[model samples]
Target chain A: MTNTLTDYISGYMDTINQQLEQFVYSLQVPERLRDSMLYSIQAGGKRIRPILLLMACEAYGGSPNRALPVGCAVEMVHTYSLIHDDLPAMDNDDVRRGMPTNHKKFDDATAILAGDGLLTASFFAITNHDLLQDEEKVYLSRELSKASGAEGMVAGQMLDMEAENQELTVEKLEQIHKHKTGELLRFSAVAGAYIGGANQSQLQSIEKYARHLGLLFQVQDDILDIIGDEEEMGKPVGSDETNQKSTYPQLLGLQGAIDKRDYYANQAKEALKEAGVDSTLLEEFIDYIQHRKK
Target chain B: MTNTLTDYISGYMDTINQQLEQFVYSLQVPERLRDSMLYSIQAGGKRIRPILLLMACEAYGGSPNRALPVGCAVEMVHTYSLIHDDLPAMDNDDVRRGMPTNHKKFDDATAILAGDGLLTASFFAITNHDLLQDEEKVYLSRELSKASGAEGMVAGQMLDMEAENQELTVEKLEQIHKHKTGELLRFSAVAGAYIGGANQSQLQSIEKYARHLGLLFQVQDDILDIIGDEEEMGKPVGSDETNQKSTYPQLLGLQGAIDKRDYYANQAKEALKEAGVDSTLLEEFIDYIQHRKK
Candidate 1:
């Protein structure tokens, strides 16, 4: 199942990359703005969000191809958030995925517009998706908006920024992660399920699984920041500490954070089992999240 | 007709403002972020976009109440653009509508997130609008995404930024205004028509009227920057000159700019006439655009 999942994801990554490239190039935008947008997207990451969307769809007996455009839209949203998060006014990061951040490679104005362009384009992608019914498109877009909007990811970002350099409780940290990272990931999982026409019970099960998976992903990220190798992480360790950001490891301690990750991973697996769907690929993803170096 | 239109608009403004206030307060966002967003919305502008949307719908025999959510949504998009455009990296304006800009009132990070929150919330508003059919909602959302996305407003903004301090042709300036301001306004007009089930020709006519109206608004803004009162305009005059922005007055002189404004205003009236819909209020709007001091 692990090998099969890996093979499936590798192929899906190629498809997603191609779709994204085509979408960006298809835009009749100013050359520099287009280049700036493509630059960040082309600076690849793990492509985890799109992969989860596609895998969830496949698990529910839907064709991955049918869900490809939606998967690509989620990736675009994720990419836009990362671009904005790296802006000078935000995280001020100089590098992303080992390359210069968008604002670093391009001017700050161009980077900001690039983020705007990508975010706007995500909605356009969904509205123009060829296969989905209009009703389905509406549902998918609404879910995406809710996940990305103020009460969700953006709120979390605000909370995270406000929490910076301050001691945070476990509840505050959970709130931040849930909004900042968890909502979008949960949306990705449920969006695929929605596209696949999963039954209500299946939908709820996958959503629960995704919630745990999202927490696990963030916890492991905290652990990696403390203990992971720079070569594998593609960024320096101790960034959270440098930024004075409260993280799972900061709140729970390194070993305690590891325990939290393990706990969520187990919960995720259990939810997948209870979903009563094909769980092999999702289970493999859970394992990957638990063990990934970066 | 002018009296009737004025009364109608005043009433609509109250309703729209109330809806906007209620909508922002309904969100469970952090206090600072919510305050930042609400501050700009509450600061008050002409509310031109939402007015156009509601009026167009009313002209097409649709219930204004049915289009109220969409009107508010367009206003949110407009507000978000203003917030982002005022960022230090962009226009860097300290004041808007006689109030400190969002970034000045709140921090830069809060302003950016607030703008993002508003933009994302606009989509959520459309999807959550209960009165419209799902298909209508999809169409409205698609039209909005196109207007606000890369090929439209954001593209225009990039071009405008890139063209700063450079000599620009009248044609180039037209391109910039069309994308930067015209697209969203055009969307506002046609969106209402779409919701009202306007025929294809009506849609085209409203789109044309909106294009001219959009250009007229920008031209008048330029003229105001040159010759209008600082008190009424709510900011200092000649800021366009100060910023080295190529405005109508800069490119074509003050009288030339006024002539241009009249030309578009007349064109807008002509398009409205040709549309064969009730044009009383829309005509008044055109006149308002042409002759307003601010």
Candidate 2:
């Protein structure tokens, strides 16, 4: 690895994967369910959600160890959502990150239970973390639940499904992605700030930064689905078109979508600057989001 | 409606139902998902889990209002489990409470998301409750997550699915029921005690009482599946036999199962008596478990 942002991300990914493995293995579930869950958690991703959490915590002067459990919890939530979204009744995808989707590797029943198990375990992970105070634990758990529950990610999915093949304005598209992808990302950033004892103004600034970054992430994903390589992206391109789901490029056109992504990225940087915290890593993260091919 | 235990239960049931209605309605989910979720929750069961929680709280001299949120939270968990269990990949039941199951009424995808929504909302309900201290909220959320997660109900369902069509020993059958049904019941009973400020010995006694009661409840369910009226039960009898599920009545003879039910009911009463708490409503609950037609 070179001394680039990619190298830094690679290091964080290694640590996050190790922590996730230990956490899932330590659960007292049956062997089959445990194996099924471990399969997906170990199936790799960028580990963006958790890494952002740790970086935010450190930038706000909290030890990364104190926020590590919350990071794992958010990752579990993300993994479980992916497992369910790829189910036959949902998006019906057969592959994720170049590996078979959970329902494909395990049966549908096991996959569903695995998702449920991970979702449930996320709360346990939050509450059982030893380093955080009880107050922080309660607040984080509540926020995570709200982000994941009917009002947030689940509702976003419902709307996305309902909006399939329908003409959508950019506003409606933003609403869908904001709830589906933004809420948990927002929670990740804000929770770390809370744990680090960030002031009210710092918390608000970090939340704004996360909101813009989340939108930028989704818009970039929309652009990638149209133009990215199949092998690098680890799945077929044009899935959004196949699903007839609304996308940023679909609403704003290709050039327009690129401009939107850049706009959000700049807004995110501005928020970070306004927050006036250590921004070296977060700035790198924003740049990575801007230029990643996959 | 008299001052008898039956009337008291009826009152509690009404209050719980209303609270559940208000909570689901207040959620910011899309209208369709909200309706689907409300449909399942409004489809009535005995509300045994939430009722047990409230009764235990009152027994420990805590006002039931203080524990109402936890009651609703447990009920949401139970409702979500039922929704998932009725999926085509799982139990595949089409009818529940004399109406279409969640998946049958809605689509499979909607049902899955609805279940996920409720499960996520459950933790939110626990932590967002205003009356409890942060410590109690954390403890209760952790307990609920453990009871509902892989090590508990989800694991039991997996074991049950795997055990189908295979002859299960009495020991294995006990293990399945203990995780599948007993853990949530145990949490309900013990959480109330904790919130109501029970002493250590009192908590133990209630936990023991709840364990016996949980097993007794399952044994009776198995017996009812054989002999109870479908109209009263609101679903077909003999589902266990149809599914090739091992039940107490299958592992032990009918008479033996009945004897086991009586034994556990008596043991529950004994534990309650030893605890030296108000036993009027709890004793009635045990009797109800023994003799209810549904």
Candidate 3:
């Protein structure tokens, strides 16, 4: 299952990079600004968000290749968020994915504009797409905005920032992750399902599946922050604890948090079954996330 | 001409404010984040861009009220730019429209999220419109993203940032304003005419009118920064000079810049006539921007 999923992702990785590169470079913006944006896009993210979008679309009987641009658009949104979050005014991280952060490599001003450029370009990738129908563009734009905007990821971030130094209940932490991280994952699956023309029942089930997967992703992140390798993880660990930010392990004991990650995994499996998504690729994702080393 | 336009603007001001207020408060975002967003929205900048949109729509026989939500959406985008520009990494301004800048009123983290929230919400405002068709939404979204995104306003800001302490020719200065300030203004007119169902020729003419009007607006802004009263302008004058930022007034003589503003105003009027837009309100906008105190 893992090999099947890896092959699927590897097959599309080149296409994804090419399309994103061509798109960003094709823009008529100033050279320096364009370079900053391109730099972040070329940075080594796991590419999990976009790969999930393609797999979901494939599961819904849509050609995954056709969904490439949309997947790249999601990656842009993801990249933009990371760029903004790493700003000195925000999380202030100097490293990302083992390389200098956007603000570190480029100046903060350029990083800010680069983030802005990527964000605005995400919508352009959709609305100006030659292959997508206007209705699809409309629906995708609406969903993307809702998921990424104040109503979703941004709201969740605000909640997380405020949660620092204060004790948050497990339920409160879940709520934050559901909005901050979950919405985009939800968007990935839902968007893929939508682009593939899934029925309402299937869309609902995929939503459930993605929601669980999102929490699973966050829990693993908290766990890794405590126990992961510094070289493989690309940055120092325990920064969250240093910041005194509450996490699943802090609220739930380490064992309890591990138990919770398993519970969400089971829920996700159940939802996937209910949705009739029998793709080995998606199943591989579940297994991969649970046991991922980095 | 002035009174008619003033009446037209006053008639719609309350509606615009109410709609923005209602839409923002109704969001399920965190309270502090919501308050930060609302603070900037409620900040007292003249609603010139939105009013221009409504007037353009009305000139084409569409009801001004029908265009109000879209206008508010543009306002959100405008407000977001101001917020981001005022960030310490950007313009580092402390005051905007007689009050603390968004980063000044709230912390930088809150300010960044607030800007992101507003930027995302602006799209939702258009895509979720009760009165718009999917095709209309699609076209509007494409234009809005291009106008506000990297291809337009963001690119312009980057150009301006790079221009600091660099000698800029008149052509270079116009190029920056065209993207920075001009793109959104261009969107306002083009979107209004589009919503009003103007012919292709009419839309093109509106685009031309808007292009000139945009440059005219910037030239006046530059002139005001030099000669305008401080209290009325709500900030210190000569800040542009203090920054050593190039402007039309600096590149051209003060009187030369004023003359150039008048030239664009006349060009705007000619395009308006060609578009067959007979609105006294739009004509008055040309006069208003030319002599605006702020």
Candidate 4:
């Protein structure tokens, strides 16, 4: 946790939060729906996705200014997924990020609409972005739709629900997370690289880095669910065990999961090195994901 | 309707339904999730939206083949909206188009995922379509997002939910439908025209046509809900009245609503005439919307 790295993240987090708030508030939507959408955006997460997007863009020697709105767009989609995942019919969680979930705060209908609004607006955000070329916008939309839709996060969600109370082999578990988290994370890196004018080869290297990082994130998340501090996580731990849901820890042992997480972290660093990207911040991210309490 | 318009519609309808099925079935998604999506898409409506898109494209001198996939994309979004609207937390509908709703056939979670999948894939479909220019794809994606997102359909859905069981003046009611049905209808015509290479002036006239056509669709919908035959509509009539939902017929007397419908139809026809379009098919559409039993 170098002060410089920490400072960098904090600075971008503040900017991301501010811009996201402005973006949602400025929408010409029903006031109540806008509020619900803004509420979740403001309900704090680490803004890891958007920050990663910006860092990846910078690593490719592009200006962060160009990536800013695109980063926010990814965050919007991510927020929508979380809100829907917390619905009574889904994960049924009443709290997220230390606050009442959108459904709990505004009711299921509002939360649903809010999620819909956010997801639906994200493509517009990208295409309507003035800084990017029209062709760049097309690529982003195509990749984004893949990352968020049936082929990606949503499919992962559906499979995860089906897997609840059922045994999942390690292969099946990895398959789930690859789509669930890996694809979006992959998009964060690859999209940034493309927008940064990286050639196809550079984009491929970044994709490799992101795939490993995504697994590292999920493995750590699974392990943290077993032993994470309740106060730090803002929710009770051991939820996976309670729900009879499979995790890397459950499928393998806890120590085994820890070993896998480190392996992914190392693999991610190697990919960054192979690409010869500006790896200082991404290397720190490897450490941060490896050791973060939440 | 003239035989030319009738034959034209039936011919395109077959191709639309066929390609839509192929598109959904071809996705490399989970079998169950894909099936759920296919179920709703195959659960027939009149394929009105896609057909309108095709007709508008042809009217503006575009080939139907080029507009085919984009039309499918619009229909996919429309279908997804219906699936989400039928959820237990939303409309709680049991049947649509004479078949069980997506949520009824599948569980709530699967239905949600299917809707999410369809909505998300639509952008990909547009961007991935080979026939359209990059510029056209960008235009369609931008318009689709606005039409489907917070500024449009989702906002309308949220407002309609809020207005449920509450008194709404005709102005408020029109505002809701304009956002709800209006934007998407506008997209169909406008996107088709753009892809067909219609100039700015032609596009504006089509926009006007679509605006009136959207209201005509809604007004007729209200009338059908009150007096439509169950067999003809393929669902029970009076459900809106049963739900105590606001409708044009409720806001205005039945005769007033009928007058409104005819007026909008006339206005839509005038717009088409002003656009100097090949208006034979669209003229039939205005009539079909006005007098269709369903």
Point to the candidate with the largest lDDT. Answer: 2
Instruction: Kindly list the per-residue Cα lDDT of model 4 for residues B3-92, writing each as its tens digit.
Output: 777898888888999999998887889989999999999898988889889999998889988999999999999999999999989989
Please, what are the lDDT tens digits per residue for candidate 3 over residues B57-132? 9889987766888898999999999999999999999998789998899999999999999999999999999898
- Per-residue lDDT of candidate 1, residues A148-219 (tens digit): 989988998999999988999988898899999999999999999888879889999999999999999999
Q: What is the per-residue lDDT of model 3 for residues A106-162, given as tens digits with 9 covering 90 to 100?
A: 899899889888888888889888888988999999999999999999989899889
Q: Tell me the interface RMSD of every candidate, in Å.
A: 0.8, 0.6, 0.8, 0.7
Where does candidate 4 clash, by residue pair?
Answer: none
Ranking by DockQ: 2, 4, 3, 1
Q: Mind giving the per-residue lDDT tens digits that candidate 2 earns over A213-284?
A: 999999999999999999999999999998888898988899999999999999999999987688888888
Better of 2 and 4 by TM-score: 4
For candidate 4, the per-residue lDDT at B252 reads: 84
Tell how far residue A68 is off in model 2, in angstroms: 0.4
TM per candidate comes to 0.99, 0.98, 0.98, 0.99
Clashing pairs in 1: none
> What is the DockQ of the complex in model 1?
0.83
- TM-score of structure candidate 4: 0.99
Task: Name the DockQ score for candidate 4.
Answer: 0.89
TM-score of chain A of 2: 0.97
TM-score of chain B of each: 0.98, 0.97, 0.98, 0.98
**Candidate 2 lDDT, tens digit per residue, B26-115?**
999899999999999999898989888988898889988889989999999999999999999888889999999999999999999999
Order the candidates by lDDT, highest first — what do you get?
2, 4, 1, 3
Better DockQ candidate (2, 4): 2
